[model samples]
Target: MGEFNLPVKQGYGENQKTSCIKCVLWGKVAEAYAPNIKKGDLLVVSGEFYVEEWVSDSGKRLQPTIIVNQIQLAKKSGDKQGQAAPTQPKATEPPVDFDNDLNIPF
Candidate 1:
């Protein structure tokens, strides 16, 4: 497993604040995606989210973590000149057809 800190921004104007979350990527996903990630690159990620608690000299510490299941590169913000988006790693397996798999009707 590989771990990284992802900073997330929320709200707007005076209410805006940035928080960092610890993300954990395991196995194939980490191997295929980690090398290609850059500081300014935008990404779309999905996974399990949870909080982990631990004790420290200061006291108990709580951290939010994500166990990334899927990740894809996204176009950088303000790229109005139509630059091509970053190439993504080829899928190791066929994508799940959620509708069919869950038997949900359109």
Candidate 2:
């Protein structure tokens, strides 16, 4: 239901403007991930690409779409590899007093 644009490199040391291509994801795949994703977030997607033709009140247009099957968020640059991420510390139990108790039955 949504689309994203990625810049492409035409040549070495040369920058050229590229057209924006639209990609679409469907079914439960889209519903499950659409809300979680945000703009400017890096992602790695595996899917099939195709061209879709449609006619609207304006005119006929062609849009490139990718049917995403798997999507994953890319790790940030500063994140270290082979290291476990930190977690919140658990609460400690209250200490018990045993010395104050006096029970002698011999």
Candidate 3:
């Protein structure tokens, strides 16, 4: 059985400048639909992002990019890879704020 509802890991969207269709995100598709993903393909993605908001010399706000952090393919279609590899636990250290909430105002 394919595990669709799974936690997603942080990844970067691989794309270059000067492209007509700016919707080809190249990264690890959120685990939800990764079970049945093709090797390589472009997709229209939407997700929470953080971008640099700056101002030009004319005091005009420059274009801010929507940096995709956690994303998933909106749709999927392909063979049901019954042989989908078993995803293992994240092999890395804990997050930066793993210890405490630290919401107190010092």
- Point to the candidate with the largest TM-score: 1
Residue 50, candidate 2: C-alpha displacement in angstroms: 0.4
Per-residue alpha-carbon lDDT of model 2 for 28-93, expressed as tens digits?
Answer: 455556666677655666576778898999999887766655566665556675334332122132
TM-score order of candidates, top first: 1, 2, 3
Estimate the lDDT of model 3.
Answer: 0.32
Candidate 1: tens digits of C-alpha lDDT, residues 1-106? 5778888999999999999888777656666677767787777777768899999999999999877766777776577856647655566543333333333221
Residues 1-106, model 3: lDDT tens digits: 1111122334456643332211112223223334434545323334333334567787855333332223333323443754333342242321122124223121
Q: Kindly report which residue stretches of model 2 are placed more than 4 angstroms away from their true locations once superposed.
A: 1-10, 55-60, 78-106
The candidate, 1 or 3, that scores higher on lDDT is 1
Cα-based lDDT for every prediction: 0.70, 0.54, 0.32
Give the true-structure RMSD of model 3.
12.7
Error of 2 at 1 (Å): 4.6
Point out the worst 10-residue segment of candidate 1 by lDDT: 97-106
